[model samples]
Target: MGERKLLSPEIVQVTVDKVNIIQAKLKAVQDRQKSYGDVRRKDLKFEELSRVHDVFHISMLRKYISDPSHVLETPEIELRDDLSYEEQPVQILGREEKRLRNKIIALVKVLRRNQIVEEATWEREDQMRSQYPYLFQN
Candidate 1:
């Protein structure tokens, strides 16, 4: 077979740029996670807060009792806009990171085809069953 061609400098630079962009995004996502408490959300540098809608401060014991003697619930509008971007599951962040990393690897592979992971031997469906008779049942 002929020798594999190397990745162009332009392709590598573009891939690097994409990787940097994703890294910045990941940092922003992480920062948002810490915004759950009041201070960070309030401290946001947004120019306008109109988008933060339907904010509420829920009381824990509101549902348990319903008597005049009980203190009245004081539900309040907490945030002016939705800051949902600040919150994402750690699993999701991990997945996103993996996705970006995979993209870089794919781009790199365009210039050079190399295996990143070796397949498990057990996945060979065409292999003779007699080779591992213990794996089969009567």
Candidate 2:
């Protein structure tokens, strides 16, 4: 057994009116928010102007102060006539052997003069010994 309760015509009309009023209010709020958001929204469409690089308007750039500590101190190196200076080995840091397909190549981590420890490079042990014989004296 089920109770069949029916709504009156006046009550149905009142419910429809309330729903329309709520929908109207919701639409008004949505339109207001959309208008506010559209103010800050940008319609970005990119078109390539050049093949070399993308060009940007200079006005978009901001002036920035260069860091004083970023300037590196230039090392005093005696350059020869051909714009090349002889790199003197300061110290031998470490030694390792790299195994290839057929043979193993001996490498020495050498720290050069007037350079930081981080700038040390790995050089072939045989070539380094031949070039700077004094480094291998010890």
Q: Which candidate comes out best when scored by TM-score?
A: 2
**C-alpha lDDT values of all predictions:** 0.43, 0.94
lDDT of 1 by residue, 30-94 (tens): 87777765454555475766676766677633566566887876644334366322211111001
Cα lDDT tens digits, model 2, 4-81, are 889999999999999999999999999999999999899999997776867899999999889988888887889899
TM for every model, in the order presented, reads 0.25, 0.45
lDDT of prediction 2: 0.94
Model 1 / residue 10 / CA error / Å: 0.2
Q: Candidate 2 — which residues are off by over 4 angstroms?
A: 1-75
